[model samples]
Target: MIHRSISEYFSPYTLQKVEVDGKEGYVLIDREGYYKGPDEGIDIALKLLLAYGDAGIQKALDDENKSIHLENMGFDFQKTGRYVRHGKPVYKRGEFDLFKRVWSFHCGFCGKKVSIDVQPEYWYIVDQHGIRKSNTLSDRACSEICAKHIWDEYLELWLKNNRYSTELGK
Candidate 1:
């Protein structure tokens, strides 16, 4: 059993209301920069930040600072790395650390060991559907071969259930 508080996981930051482009929204302030999102309340914003994870939130802040620096230097667009989608800056997604944390596990298909020796690309994390815990996966594959085999089996079931109505009538 792990005991932890919400505050324990979050980095020190301040939340406040701010106006951007004549529209009101909330911003979270930290040492690096502020995170601006929709006009959602403070609680929702906090939840969003928490879901993004500490490292992700820091990345967003750093990206924002970099953007500001470039704009100040008269660059119309960022030099590299940052992505803009539909006129808003899109931050990079953080690397999922679950694989590293649960390093010692048997392949869900063949019961093979998944380790650093087994190149990272070969392994797959299969998120189980309809499970009680979101933190865990229903199955994992130690190699690409196992993953494809498992997916092929799953696809058969999916096709059976999702067949066209006309095809079923025939």
Candidate 2:
């Protein structure tokens, strides 16, 4: 049998109301269980908290119900050549389109130009090979926020579809 700490077994991210100096704000507990400074700002922190909360709830439901496999509906990771100091290979979702021509797409969440080579906007990856794959959604976004929004929308749609299928016994 294996052993795991509560923090390790549970989520690595936590939101806490904290005070620094004379100001009060929220701080995030990072993966290492260390208090990350409040430099992430309140809005982003709240958004991250909501996203993580949704993820945790979904995880629990998935574990207990087992009717829906959300992991199989998520991203498809590919091994990259890069490795960390711990000898673990870095994984990425989509290969960079480095075929010489300029490829661009509008962000699925925010209407912004995303290109292979651009400032303030770059490539984002969506699961290309999955039941949740969408042609209407762009494969790229301008920022992490937009990317998360796109993913959330996709997941919502996928869950709805799956629920309908299971209910209808299809």
Candidate 3:
């Protein structure tokens, strides 16, 4: 069993064993505070540690255990899933670890996480409707959905700045 402790989880909130797709699977703590690394800090440091997979993760966990009296580190997790705060059933997916797990880009417009084999590309953008739309350029590949999402987000910013604000009356 994969055992990990997130500074974000309840002391009792632990990993549970469950079958997924007829294979050995773990119920990752989908709760918030699942990760307690530095906030708004360099993501590379944290992700680099996690990229180690089983052996690497174990070492980190071991290191954390060694520092019980000092700084707490990764976790004692025997499972293979990352921490998610609250574990709510928003059915929301998260950024997968490319170092450890292979992933397909989820279209920004479509919201479909494609398999790496399907496109052999990098990340993607999803759509509001959760379907495949476009993909990032091969050299700089991202999904069309993500592209659109970014576009929409940009447009919203543009509109916000360009559009007249009624609150200006106040």
- Kindly list the per-residue Cα lDDT of model 1 for residues 4-98, writing each as its tens digit: 37876566666767799999965666646656345434676678777676666666666666545445433343332212223432222123354
For every candidate in turn, the CA RMSD to the true structure comes to 19.8, 20.3, 23.1
**TM-scores across all candidates?**
0.29, 0.37, 0.22
Candidate 1 — worst ten consecutive residues by lDDT sum?
161-170
Clashing pairs for predicted structure model 1, backbone only: none
Off by over 4 Å in 1: 1-102, 117-121, 125-138, 164-170
A best-first ranking of the candidates according to their TM-score comes to: 2, 1, 3
> How well is each residue in 1-170 modelled by candidate 2, as lDDT tens digits?
22347765676567777788979866678777787665655656687587567746666555535423532333222222111112331212343456667767777678877665665345354343454545554756677666655655654555476662322211
Runs of candidate 2 with Cα error greater than 4 angstroms are 1-99, 116-121, 135-137, 164-170
TM-score of 3: 0.22
What lDDT does each candidate get?
0.48, 0.52, 0.39
> At residue 93, what lDDT does model 2 achieve?
36
Q: For residue 39, give model 1's deviation from the true position in Å.
A: 53
Q: Write the per-residue lDDT of candidate 3 for residues 56-132, one digit (tens) a residue.
A: 67766655554452122221123311121123211233444557777454454555556655654544222212111
RMSD of 2: 20.3
Query: For model 1, what is the error of residue 64's alpha carbon versus the real structure, in angstroms, after optimal superposition?
Result: 47
Off by over 4 Å in 3: 1-100, 123-142, 161-170
